[model samples]
Structure formats: structure tokens, C-alpha cells
Target: MRHTPPRAVEVHKALLAHFGPVDWRPSLPPVDELVSTILSQSTTDGNRDRAFERLKARFGSWEVVRDGEVAAIEEAIRVAGLARQKAPRIKAALQFITDRRGALTLDFLRRMPVEEARAWLMQMKGVGIKTASIILLFSLGMPAFPVDTHVHRTARRLGLIPPNTNAEKAHYLLEAALPPETYLDAHLNLIRLGREICRARKPDCPRCPLRAMCVYAREQGSGGARE
Candidate 1:
């Protein structure tokens, strides 16, 4: 853990204010979220959605997708930009879940504590902390905050976290401070804020709600805190 900063709280509040009552995530079966998150790794959401739609349309069921040919799965998700690499892992993850729990329902993971569920998800072949946290937060509605590139960059710029704070450490640091109930909405709000205002290359500081709290903005003198 690191020293707490007032800027962090201010930025968090400003993001929540702008993104008001975040509710973008849809409840899905845990396996679906896991698969979708994997598909989304290096691709846009539109392409990932297209790939997911193809998988659903082609397979007709999760069971079919789990047992389908790797090539077929790759073809279905080709639009996601890494189908060749992602295909086997996605299939393997589905198989892993079904083998362990018989069903890929959110109930299995959602029933456990965040730490335990995170461990369970990480056991899957392609799932890492970020992916696992996503499953816990989005699928199970658990108190796991996932830090993507946007959140990581914004936190660093706002001086909410120290330089080069890895996503795993950042996750723990953030979750420890915020109430568990705020985890879901905060994650969404932060992502929206990151995309809309606190962009990586060119932050819209003048129009930003948390402009007053941004160390990078205050330090335009330091050439804008390039990473």
C-alpha cells in the first residue's frame, strides 16, 4: 500500500458525478462474461460483440461452443483481431469451467468471497488478474475493481497512484479504500471518465470535472507527465 492522496478521492467523486449512476454492464452467465472479456482483449467492443454473436449463432449453446473445433471457433471470432491466438484459450476456458462446476452460471463464483472467486477464475488458462477481476465485478456483481489501461493511466496522472503501479497492486489498493458497494459503479464511471475526458495522449483538462485535482494538469509546466 501507498500513501493516500486527496486527489484520488476528488477524481473518484468527479468521475462518479460525470458518469452518473453507471449501469452499462449487463448481467450474463459467468462463462459468457469470461469469454467475452477474453474476446475483448485486443479488439474493440463492436468487433467483440460481432464475434460473440457469431459464436452464439453458430453453436446454439455454451456446450457446443465449449466442445467445438478450435478452427471453427477461430473463424467465428476472427473479427475480434486475435482469433488465432484467442481461439484455443477461449475454448479451453469454457471447458475448464464446465469441468469444475458442471454449469458456467454466475452463481458458482458469485457465491464465494471476492478473493476466492478471483483465485478460481485465475485458474482458467487464459484468465489473468484483470480478466478475473472483470468476471468478478461484471458477472458476479462482486466488489472487484479491474484497472484497464485507461484507469491505470488516469490514476497515475491524477497522482492517485505512484508511478508504474501495476494493475494487480492498483486493484488491491483501490478496493481496500472504497466501500465494496461502490466497486461496480466506480469501475464503470472511471472507465467512462477515462475515455471521455482523461484521454491518454491529450487530456481535456479545461473541461474536466476533476481538473482541479489533477497533478498532471497542474504540472503542465512538467510537459504534461508523459509516461
Candidate 2:
């Protein structure tokens, strides 16, 4: 059976009881978060961090990065991997923002409805639903649920969402099912669960807090259930 909103809420509560509260708030401006999220694509967090720091240290400002040579941008973020692709995309996103809004700031999104803001961000070449939701929720403090790989996988295993739902559709569906206030905590906890317990390969389902409710755990039989 497809999981209902109440079941999703139950999963959220169980996760909270296990992992406690997490602060997923973004400490950077929207533009910075946008670039950081872009840099994070197909890379480890450590590499993304290094690349972001390097890019900032080299350019000192988004305006400079926006106008800087593509080669320099690629070199600065080389550690992130896919610099050839990410560099031009990042520059193009910034340029698009600058041209459309007459500035590089994403603060204006705070005034737009959440969906409107997401749509605006998605219009950028490299920004997809996940990236846009990250920018909206983390940067703008808006109610957007970003369905990253971890969240997507965890949700499917828990039957909170369909197993075949695409990340883009999962983003909207999850946001609709979950309470607005639960988005950040749920997002963080699900990611932690995916990383530490409900891993992609050979999940440590025996120790998972959601094992009782997870379809994947049940399918794994008693081996996944702790004594």
C-alpha cells in the first residue's frame, strides 16, 4: 500500500526520536548557496567544500566570478570534478540571475511564492528541482522539500513515496505530504539515515530506527530486524 501522510509523519517522529534535532539552516547567502549546491553535483561534500572555498578565495566575489574567465573558474573549482561542465554552468546561472534581476542576489525570491521561486530558479540552465529546492529552503527559509538521492532512496524504502518516483516529482509530492515545519528536519534525518544506516548498498537495516516500518527492511526478512 502507498504510504499515507500520517505514515510519513510517523516516520518523521521515529527519525526524530532516533537522531534528535538537526539544524539544516544555511549560513550563506542565496547566491553562495546556489553556487555551493551546483558545485555539490556529482561530488563529495569534502570536494565541494574545497572547490567552493577555492573559487571564493580566487575570485573574492560572485560578481568577479560571474565576469571572470571560464578557464579560471574551471581551474578554481577543479577539485569538485566536472569543472569543465560545472564552471560554465555556474557562470551562466549567475549571469542569468544578474541579467534578469539586475543583480546577483536571490533575496527577491523570499517575496515570491514558493512554487514561483522554484520555477524561476529551474529556468536557469543547470538548476533542477533539487537545486532550486535547496536554494529555496536553505537560502530563503522557504517551505521546500529537496529530494536528494538520500531522501529519495530512504523515502522509497520506507514507502513514504513510490519506488519509481523521479527526484523531481518526489520533491513536490514529499513537500505536499509532509508538514512545512518538518521539511528541514525530515530532509536532514533521512539523509543521515541513508548515509549511516539505510545505505545504498548493503544497508545496515538491522540497526535502522525505521526498520519496523520500512518495506525494504521487511523484505530483507528477520535478518534486518534487531532482536
Candidate 3:
């Protein structure tokens, strides 16, 4: 038998039906996506985008960012919050890529095995599993699954992952639970659900399409128990 969550496929299908077509495509180039994701840490989408635009407008290229002063980078991204920290990581990541590949582009990861590519990205100064996975999956179309805050919370509520699983562990659990082909759709739909319905403070369980399979809804006495 496949060592997968029993109802993982069912939950994925329900989310797809609820969200309609998950039209998530790789929007940014690999290097841009990498830097954008780093800026997104602990910040709202609007703030992240503003910071990214400012940084881009200021430097115009990652190579310049790599060679630029840390103070300049930090000033460019102060709106993203934690610029004092994120700026260094972003610059360090760019430098690491340049040093390792003899170029500033992340295009080489396309030819490596997905796991190897993911591991290589994580070796950068501030890149972690989520950031690396997002870069590979979103930008490079690799099979890696990214488990963000929304994905982690929703998966646990749906009983697809163990309740005690942390964000890092949830990455592997969710990747194993769903098929590689469904990774992008599943990841995007889960985030939509979490942000729109399964909110942190007020989950609209009764309206959630996956409520029938959600342990959180059942625990709240709002839905039938999962079969």
C-alpha cells in the first residue's frame, strides 16, 4: 500500500472543486522569486511587493545587489519589516549563487534533481526549506511542495498531517500526502482556503468544503466526523 495519508487525495479534490481552476503559474524568474520570497517573511503581501519593487528600482539587478552595500539594501527593503535581517540574507544568497555557479542566475537548478536543487538552495545564508521549496516549485516548476503557514494549518485541520507537526515537518508530510502533479494546485488552494475561510481566529467551518474531513470542525461540533 502507498504510505500516504488515507484521505489526502479526497481533500485535494475537494479543495480544487471549491477553488475552481488553480491558475497559479510561475510569475517571476527563478532569481526574482527567490529574492521576493525572502522579503515576504513575516510580512504582508503588500509590504513584500513594495519592498521588492523598491529594491528592484534601486539596484535593477541581483548582481548589483550582491555587490551593493548592506546599508543600501536594508534601506531599500525597510518597509518589508526585518530589513535589518532580510537584507543581509538576500545579498548573501545572491553572492552564494554567484560563487557556486559562477553566475548570478538560478537557471542551473533546472537540470539538477529536485531534491538536490532544493538542498543547494537551502545552503544559502537565510534560505530554509519553505523558501527553497517555493523557489523550486513556483519558479523552476520542480516537484517540491512548499508548506507555508496556511498550508500547515489547513493540513492539520483536515487531518492530513499530524496535529503536532511543525511547519518544517509539515513540508515532508504534505509532499508525501499528495501526488507531485497536484503539489502546485494543492498548495495554492490550501492557501486560498486558509486566507478566505479557514481563518486563524474565525474559521468558517460550516462553509468550508473540506469540513466533512476536517478534525478541527468536528472538534468544534460544527461538522460530521470524518469517515
Best by TM-score: 2
Q: Relative to the true structure, how large is the alpha-carbon lDDT of every model?
A: 0.80, 0.91, 0.90
Per-prediction TM-score, please? 0.91, 0.95, 0.95
Q: Against the true structure, candidate 2 has what lDDT?
A: 0.91
Candidate 3 lDDT, 132-181, residue by residue in tens? 99999999999999999999888888888889999998888888888899
Q: Give the root-mean-square deviation of each candidate in angstroms.
A: 2.6, 3.1, 2.8
Comparing candidate 1 with candidate 2, which one achieves the higher TM-score?
A: 2
- Candidate 1 on 98-217: residue-level lDDT in tens? 788787555767678889989988988888999999888887778898989888877777777777789889988777656677777777777777888778876777777777777788
Judged by lDDT against the true structure, how good is candidate 3? Answer: 0.90
Q: What's model 1's TM-score?
A: 0.91
Over the stretch 1-227, how does candidate 2's per-residue lDDT look in tens digits? Answer: 44447988999999999999995547989999999999999999999999999999999999999999999999999999999999999999999999999998899999999999999999999899999999898888999999999999999989988888888889888987888989999999999998999877878887988888889888877264332
Candidate 3 residue runs with Cα over 4 Å from true position: 1-6, 223-227
**Candidate 1, position 94, lDDT:** 80
- The superposed Cα distance between candidate 3 and the true structure at residue 197, in angstroms, equals 1.2
Q: Could you tell me how far off, in angstroms, the CA of residue 45 lies in candidate 3 after the best superposition?
A: 0.9
Best-fitting candidate, scored by lDDT: 2
